[model samples]
Target: MTMLRRNLMHAKRYPSMTFSVVVMPVILLLIFNFVLGGAMQAGVGGDDSKYINYLTPGMLLLLPAYMTAAIAVLVSTDVTKGIVNRFRTMAISQSAILTGHVMGTLIQAVLALGAMLGVAALCGFRPEATPIEWVAAIGLMLLIVFALGWLSVAFGLAAPNPESASNMPFPIIMMPFLGSGLVPTDTMPVGLRQFAEYQPFTPFTETVRGLLMGSEIGASGIISLAWCAVIALVGYLWAKSLFRKQSR
Candidate 1:
């Protein structure tokens, strides 16, 4: 609890980070919902509903987006101030500090995600899920985002600067749009379609959308969980190593 509080303070120290994390998603949502409505219907791209549905699931994955921004700020500022190195000599539990920061980012990510939902509501968008479906959706969001938070921490702590940390999620973030997050895999060429079907975000987006739609789990949820688990495990190890080395 104490560590969580401290991590919250870390975010509070940089309000701009919080604002930024939510802004891009908002813009993307707006662009898709309004500006691109005609193009989406022309089949020049794909179904906007399918795209939004996929994005909705990916938005659950977006907790990582917020975490990446916040972590960049936190790690960069601490390193710049030399507090990280000083703290290495303190009694603080090594993993606790890093994990605590991750937890806080998870919380902020949840809030930002809720804000995204609010935007969805304002835009007259609605998912036809039931109560249990809603509960499952929220739970899924928490788990995926929490896992992705570790990835954010790893990148933020390991990167050369906050700017780099912020850019780290860019590739992953763009994956959703370019792959299955906003369009059907079958909509693309055979090669790209195959790649999209197999990519990490494809499963993640599909599973969450399926769950929200009360459809069968199939393999999407399983695959998404596996990807999250692996990323979290690797990210934890790397972040811990960097924290020990840099903070030392």
Candidate 2:
């Protein structure tokens, strides 16, 4: 509970940064939805909306990829400013203090997703099933975010400063082009295509596309769960080790 409160307080203190997260996705959604909306198509279902449909799932998955990894920068910022050392001198729960920032990232992920969904609706994507399916889809997205969040935490702690964390996402931003976000992997070079097709982001994006379009894109939905489990396990373990080392 204290973790949640501290995270929420941080969020309130940094409303502009929080707003940028939401706004960046929206801006990307519109740009993609308008320019490439008609050229993209996936699955057999009738839901063929572009930009929002194509971009939303990608945003849903990759947002955390960038957001979490970038947290290294925030952590770096706090530490470089001596805030973390100051806090360490006080009596703060080791786990709560470390995880509290992650909670803030998670909260940002949820809010940004909500804002993206609103954009999706405005652009003509609709649910064909019950709200439970929407919830389930969101749950899947959240799982990915959580897994990626830990990676961010680890990176933030391990990074020399926040600027390093800030720069970590540049390589990640290009992932969508290689995955299902921009074009079908079938259309790319054989080797790169295979990598993109098999990568974790591919499956996760496929799952989101499946949920939004009311049909399966590929075996991606199944693969997505597997990726989430593996990443969650590995990321959390690494983050835990880092947290322990930092506190020591």
Candidate 3:
């Protein structure tokens, strides 16, 4: 709890940084809903407003990706400043440090996602989900964030400096673009469509969209869960290993 409070306080101290996490996704939501919605709508066979329904889930998935840099930068800054070292000298639980970071990232993700959902509601986006489905969707999103948040911490620890750490997670931002986030995978060329269908982000995005829109999740739900589990395990181990090496 102490570590978590400390991390949250650090985030509060830099409002602008966290504010960008909320703003960027909202801006992109507006642009895609207004400017690019028509062209994108063609693939989904719906009007712009209806398209917003499809797009909102994708944007929600993209939110954490965009915020990955901030998490990486924050962790790397702490490492660079020798804060991790100082903490090691204390009697505090070492795992609390990483857990605090993960919790902080999840909170930021929820805020950013909520902001985007609010804008989406204003823009005529509505899902057919029941209360249970809505809860499941939120859980799924947090699971994804939890997995990726750990990876971002690992990236931050791996980078030579904070600036490079911030850029190291760039591929996550592009994961949506390469998946079915923007358009139907069937609309893509065979190769790209194959890639889109098989990628980790697509299954998760599709699962969220399915849950929210009352569509079939089928195998995508299982795949998404599996992906999240694998990522969270790997990232936790990787981040812990890095921290241990730093301590030594």
Candidate scoring better on TM-score of 1 and 2:
1
Q: List pairs with backbone clashes in candidate 1.
A: none
Off by over 4 Å in 3: none
What are the clash counts of all predictions, listed in order?
0, 4, 0
Candidate 1 clashes: the total is 0
Clashing pairs in 3: none
What lDDT does each candidate get?
Answer: 0.71, 0.71, 0.88
lDDT score, candidate 2, position 73: 67
Error of 3 at 90 (Å): 0.5
TM-score of each: 0.87, 0.86, 0.97
State residue 234's C-alpha deviation in candidate 1, in Å.
Answer: 0.6
Candidate 1 residues 54-95, lDDT tens each? 455555555554456567657666666676766677887767
lDDT (tens digit, per residue) of candidate 3 on 1-248: 88888888988998887888778878888888899999889998956669888888888888878778888998999999998889999998999988898898888787777888888999998899999999999999999999998999999999989999989999888898888788889999999999899889999989999999987788999999999999889989999999999889
Candidate 2, residues 6-125: lDDT per residue as tens digits? 667867887776676667767777766677566564422234554455566776665776576546666667767887777778787766766777777777788778877787788875
User: What C-alpha root-mean-square deviation, in Å, does candidate 1 show against the real structure?
Assistant: 2.7
